[model samples]
Target: MKQLMQALIDQGARLIGLVGLPPMGCLPAVITLTSPFSPRQCNESLSQIAIDFNQKLQSELKAMQTDQGPTIVYFDIYQPLIDILQNPSQFGFDETNIGCCGSGLIEATFACNVGSKICPDPSKYVFFDSIHPTEATYNYIFKKMQPVIDEIIQGQ
Candidate 1:
């Protein structure tokens, strides 16, 4: 990470944003794979791993952000996403466990297609496929990140 940052700095890059990992256990794919019977529940083990990684990453990023080259910003999408998943109705999301495409249990990428079954409203789902977030979910994340982005831009 330090090397990459230096490389970017060498090329005249100033501001850098690093996104934290989402709760992988809450994703449709992980739930389907690890807790098929209890689809609504997320795999806590995987979620913990992501959480730990995010914490470490945040710490590292903070250490990297000196008066040296670039201003490294760590964008935490984990908490906001988890908040939405825990309270779907708050974010206008009806489905937090399953995705909008196909069975929403395991389908992803090319597996989601015209032939595959889809939810009536994609906006009501947190995930578009098994692993990706829907547009609405991304909108929420973007809004949450807006303040930080504004601060970075204003500072520059």
Candidate 2:
């Protein structure tokens, strides 16, 4: 990823925005697979991997930000996602353990199609399906990322 970003810089790109991975362990699909209980929770081990990967990416990006390198901005999407999971009520989401579409367990993409059962209120759920977030979740993340994005745009 760093190499590709650097190559883009070499190709005359002045600004590069890198969005870090979200908390994969906290995803409904991952919880269903890893959790032993009925109401699944986040798999800490899996979450750790995402955190570690993001940290490594941040470190590498910092190292690569020499005088010749392009202005690279690392947008930390992990923390805000984690915050939403931990405090769903604060984010106006009532469901954090499961998704809004289908059974809210393993359904994703095609499985969450027309015939699938959906929740009455999608806004109450953080995820649209097992692997994907709802529009509200994305909007919340975008709002949280705005300050960093603005700073980057201002060259701060």
Candidate 3:
């Protein structure tokens, strides 16, 4: 990922923003797959991996940001997502453990079709599908990352 970003900078890109990975363990699909007793519970082991990877990515991005390199900004999508999951009510989310699509357990992509059962209110759910977030979740994430985006845009 760093190599690809550096390549883009070498091609005359002035501003480069890298979005770090989110909490993989918190995803409904991962929870369903990993947690046998409690599918709704987050798999801490997988989340740790994501956290470690994000930290390394931050370090690498910092190292890559030199005087001649493009204005590189690392957008953290992990912490805020975790915060939302921990306190769903604060973010106007009623459902955090499961998705809005199908059984809200394992449905994603092709499985989350028109035939699949959908929640009455998608805005109440953090995830639209087992593997993906809803528009509301995306909006919240965007708001959290907006400040960093502004800084990158202003070349600060």
Candidate 4:
């Protein structure tokens, strides 16, 4: 991660925003793939991996930030996503465990087509498909990242 950041910096990138990894364990696809019998539950082991990686990346970014050179900001999506998944009601989400398309487990992309089964209201669901979030979820995520985005724009 540091190497990649350095590469980008070397290429004359001044301000950089590093987005943390979302909770893959909490994703419907991962849940379905990892726990077929109990698709509603998240795969903790996968989520822990993302958590550990985010911690290391955050620590590295903190160390990289100095008064002398380029500005770097760590935009956290992991914690906010986890919070939304854990407490869907807070974010006006009725369904957190599954997506809105098809079975809301493993179907995505081509499989989740126009003719495919979908929920009546996608806004109520956190995910649109197994791997992607709904517009509403992205809106919530954007709200969480707005301050950082504003800071970036203002700094520039």
lDDT of each: 0.91, 0.88, 0.89, 0.89
Give per-residue CA lDDT, model 2, range 1-156, as digits (tens): 766886797799888888888999999988988984775889988899999999999998898887866787789889988999999999999999789998788899999999999999998999999989998999999999999888886875
State the local distance difference test value for candidate 4. Answer: 0.89
Deviation of model 4 at 122, angstroms: 0.8
TM-score order of candidates, top first: 1, 3, 2, 4
Q: Name the lDDT value of residue 138 in candidate 1.
A: 97
**Number of backbone-clashing residue pairs for each candidate, in the order shown:** 0, 0, 0, 0
Error of 4 at 21 (Å): 1.3
Best by lDDT: 1
Give the range of the ten consecutive residues with the poorest summed lDDT in model 1: 32-41
lDDT of 1 by residue, 28-89 (tens): 99998888895368998999999999999999888878787688999989999999999999
**Which residues of candidate 4, in runs, are more than 4 Å off?**
none
In candidate 2, list every pair of residues with a backbone clash: none
Model 3 lDDT per residue over 1-156, tens place: 777986797799988778898899999988888884553699999999999999999999888889977888889999889999999999999999789999888899999998988999999999999989999999999999998787766865
Q: Alpha-carbon error at 92 in model 4, in Å?
A: 1.5
Among all candidates shown, the one with the greatest TM-score: 1
> What ordering of candidates by lDDT runs from best to worst?
1, 3, 4, 2
lDDT, candidate 3, equals: 0.89
What is the lDDT for 133 in model 3? 92
